[model samples]
Target: MHIEKNILDNVNIWLTPTFDEKTQTEIKEMMTSSPKELEESFYKNLEFGTGGMRGVMGVGTNRINKYTLGKNTQGISDYMKTAFPGEELKVVIAYDCRHNSDTLAKVVADVFSANGIKVYLFSELRPTPELSFALKYLNCHAGIVLTASHNPPEYNGYKVYWQDGGQLVPPQDGEIIQVIEALTYDQINFKANENLIEYIDAKIDEAFVKSTIENASFDTPAEAKDNLNIVYTSLHGTSIKSIPDVLSKAGYSNVNIVPEQAIPDGNFPTVKSPNPEEPEALTMALALAEKLNADIVVGTDPDADRLGVAVRDNDGKMVLLNGNQTMVLMTAFLLEQWKKAGKITGTEFIGSTIVSTPMMLELASAYGIECKVGLTGFKWIAKMIKDFPNQKFIGGGEESFGFMVGDAVRDKDAVGATLLICEIAAQAKANGSSLYKELQNLYVDHGFYKEYLISLTKKGIEGANEIKQMMIDLREKPLKEINGQRVIMVEDYDNSTARNLFTDEIEELKIPKSNVLIYYLEDGTKICARPSGTEPKIKFYFSVNEPLDSIENAKEVENNLDQKIKNIIAEMQLQ
Candidate 1:
């Protein structure tokens, strides 16, 4: 544990906080643990990395708590006052249904209020994108949303958004970290100026919904909306109000919220994980869809930014769509509608993360729109829009179910995504075409892009060390081949360079330094490997593309592609 002496001193002080007996008792138990364990826990401070603070909930400097949240907020308020000076800076605050999420939101509000910054705090739980939209709608200088997104039950986090409603990147991330590093435990003022903190409720919600509806492009009539029998679930988080209301107002009357998971509960009682990407998380939603013979089953994570969906195939069996498939459907739907609705003019653009499905580029290109790839986070998506105000952003998404629609918000928005998705579903239903069929058509028009994500979980301090070593080994000796194909290019995102292994040509990467490596084969196969920033897991993304001559061969090509992916995984020692 390479830790600063000042950081070490600070840990000791936090472990001995004079606030409550409960925290003191917990710290006593940790102090009495194995010497090595105690050292690992207290040695270093939790870093406010690229996306901000995300960690297990506990009583430590390396954990998410009122103190850390306070420090981060105070630093941010200070930065905002400097960045957007001569203006009365206000901030919009929202929280998911995570445990202590409301408490953390209030903590941030109080901290900001003490700084004499006006705070618009959501009265009830809300999705991440709503916080983003609220920031823009209220014309606030910045925003914060309390959510770890789809992290495990023990985890909670805070995502900082610039005035544009996207997460901070590059200079901003570094600048905020600098400001936070200057904050001591005593420097964070948790005391609130009651007058400066306003509890916002229905007025904002109504205005937000109105703005969403005005922005949305719906093609179906209210009479045809009932044809789209959609089964929706929040997975026991914060999407309940926003998603349903958005769909209803968009003229889709047949949307049904999953009974068991409709309500917000931080414990997420029904599912082992609250993430929609997990099949078990959608178990109840799937069964309900099956019983109701619904067109699709959609699930949103706790924060409601990332959306997952399943559609009924020709066989009448409900099929789960991976992140890439969902991206293709949504991106294609938006581009098609945006053009017909006169929204795709001038420097129209779309965005996606490099690790996301490449189908976005294929669709955007077909639409004559420029598609830009960002680093893994959605902040870059928002930043690009900010940089190019003349360009209209259609939509952007990652394969992990996070999608951003329009230029209104910078982050992945389940609120707007849900509304837009419902409209897409309604259009298909009106035309007697299901989303599943529409997806197959996209696969036919664009090359079928199949992607598989494999993650290896490594827990605790020793696990992190192992991950570091793995990256070191890969950097030292790169892979030569995978599944009988020559590795043509090696892209080391950490070094911000790509080397053509065969020709020995090198080029610069546009993104910041991150410990990620991607190998591109001669046949266009891509395999990306990187460790998760917020979780103790390393993920490998495998992508393969094959042309579909006709709809009949979709199954055969899919089968061959699946086997090919498995062979490549085994060759790379990832299986």
Candidate 2:
């Protein structure tokens, strides 16, 4: 329950800070509230790791506040000067509707401006993808978005992007971390230089809308504009302002919005979690879809960077599509369209996370092109594109519903996804096909693939230790089978190697070391386990596949796959 010593003491001398009355009052309140809570809040500064700084909003070193934001900005500014000295460095900044998000964004802008960097700041709320596009559109050196994606209302974060407009990667990520950890709290200049910061608004949005639609457009129109019924919800976040407009511009006249969930409320009034991946989160949207008798329903997370979708099946029952299904659906639609246009001259390559549905790889192979798999983050996908400058990257996505469809931006793009999903729906309807039918078509041709994701949460001080212990236990004792099939191989991403139990062989994985474990079964089952870097939880991904026959039995086969997955997890005792 105490501070982890020697772990971060090398920077202890920089802990003492100077702050104003509001910040002082908050800290004093925390100090008076159970000495244990104070240590938990101030024992260490919020981390600037691969995903940038994310934590609960509070007034301490371990919390996310103006001071922490300023320090992070100052460190980024310092690193920028070294990375590009004597150059006019500019950073595009955007924020979500999270508590004090705009205030923290302004703190970031002030720190950058004080460091003599140019700032392209949003005058109002916008999706995180727009921030990524702004970096490329404005030709800024990097970008930052103040959001924690779908995390709880109490959490906020700072996501750093590179010149590529994606999250920072590789040597740069490590270099920035080093720069951030070395800064003295007193050295960060929080003074505003308003003259250097420009407030940006809808003008940028106009450009984003055009680029998003143009990229998602097809050669010819599908059916009548009102033929498709679509329902959408922003989940009480930032997308409400733009999604309707985007769909209208894309020629979808029957788009219906979930009235109650349209507003940008940080409390997320209706749902336990704002994440669209949860069925509960999509309850309101689905109800509206059912009432409107819509063809498709969709929702986005708080920042609108991640997306979720659902559609009606042949049985007339509505079901939500997981991240993998969404990606596979989108990829199949896009690739088929582009191939018909002859846009891909065999030089194009697409990318997705290794944890994403393997269905994409099969889909890509069917088209006779390359499908590269990156680590579980889109930063790695962007890195792959950057590493191969000559290869054309049509789209890339992760299993978390974060997708970047065009080369114009490096981050996951909800705008592009919005238009793409609508287009896919239109294409299906025009071809007398449903999204479910198209998915089954792919399954029938390339074999059926099913995937599942499970997350285990650990809370408070004991949670971290418990997660660590779980990882230790898994590594020490490997499972021989998952639901009857013999174990084929185990890929321990932590050590960056895959071990084949049959041959007693070990092969190197291309990516760097990360604390992840994967257990593969001979029957095409995959289970991936990793502790969350920011939150107090561990996530496990399960994937299993089988053959697909006639569409009539697709439902039964799907239920079978679901039960098989459950049995596998039960054998593993994750239940």
Candidate 3:
């Protein structure tokens, strides 16, 4: 139970008068009876990653608490003052349905307001995208949201956004971290200036909803909208209100919500985790879809930024669609709708992440629309949107079940994505088809791409070191082949270079440097390895594709692709 000298020093700092009485009492208890816990909590300060800060909720420097939040807010406040000198600084703050989210949000607003920055705080809990939209709509310099997107209830997060309505990227994120690291606990101003804190009214909500509606490509026919039985669950988060409101406003009257999950509960009582990426998270929604004989079922994460969808396949059974399938289906549908509406101006473009299905590139190419790939996270996708002001951004998404339909909200918007998905389903129903069938049609038109992801969780300090070493080992000894297929290309994003294994020629990568390694096989297979920035885990994404000439062979083709990915995993010893 011996604590390192540095850890003990860090712990003692919190026991001082600088911290509140409650925090000091907790620290004292940990020091006296729970030295191990104290060491874990004070081993190091919670890292402010490229996007923002996230960690388990507790009373320590390494954990997310009032003090950590205060320090971060003050750092942001100082950065804002310096970033925009001599101007009236403004920031919008929002929170999701997480423990201490509202309180943390208030603390954030207080810090901003105390620093002479105007604060537009949401009157109540709202989705992350709405917060992003409000930041832009209100013309604020920065914004913050209090919620870990899909993490467990014990975990919470702070996501920062800039004026362009996207998460902070590049020099901005690095600059903010520098400011945060230079400040001490006592430097933070936790006092509130009530006069400078303003509650965002319903006007912002109305505008957000309007923008979502306008982003819809197809108008749901009254008959299809009325007859389409849609089952949705917010997974006990912020989308409970916004999703239904947008669906109802979009002329959908037959929407059925999972009653148990409709309530906003940070505990996520009904499911093990609130993430829609896991099929288990959508179990209740799928069951409801079965009972209601619905056409489609959709669920959003706690923060309502990512979406998970399920639709009745041709076999008359409901099945969950992976993040890649959802993106492909939605992207194809949007392209078709745009083509039909004559909105394809040859200047339109779409975007996806490197880990997402390569079919996105193919789909965009088929329609003569540009497709750009970025590193993981929607922030990179938003950066692409910002980079292409001359070209229209139709949609963008990643394989993590996140999607952004239009530029209105730069980040992945579940509310708008849900609405657009329903519209796509309704349009399919109107055409005597279903979303599953549409997916099959897309596969038939383009190629069939199947994607699978495996995430290995490594916790604590030792685990972090292990994960770091794993990445280093992979970089030093890159994979030469996988599953009897020759490795054609190796992309080392961390070093910002891509090399052709066959020719030994190298080229610079256009994207920012990230600790990710991607391998391209000669048989059109892709394997991506990257560690999570916010969580203690490493993720490997596998994507394999083949031509699908007929719907009758879809199951066989899909099974083959799945087996190929399994073989790749086995050969790579990832199992």
Q: Give all TM-scores, in the order shown.
A: 0.96, 0.96, 0.98
Q: In lDDT terms, which candidate is top?
A: 3
Q: Which lDDT tens digits does candidate 1 get at residues 248-351? A: 77777888888888888888899888888888888999999988998888899999888888888878899898888887888898788878878777489888
Error of 3 at 252 (Å): 0.4
lDDT of 2 by residue, 218-325 (tens): 743746446878999999998876778888887888888888888899899999999988889999889888888888998999898889999988776788988888
Superposed by TM-score, candidate 3 places the C-alpha of residue 149 at a distance from the truth, in angstroms, of 1.2
- Answer with 1 or 3, whichever has the higher TM-score: 3
Candidate 3 similarity to native, TM-score? 0.98
Clashing pairs in 3: none
Ranking by TM-score: 3, 2, 1
Off by over 4 Å in 1: 1-10, 15-22, 33-37, 342-346
Q: Give stretches of model 2 more than 4 Å off.
A: 1-17, 220-222
Segments of candidate 3 deviating more than 4 angstroms: none
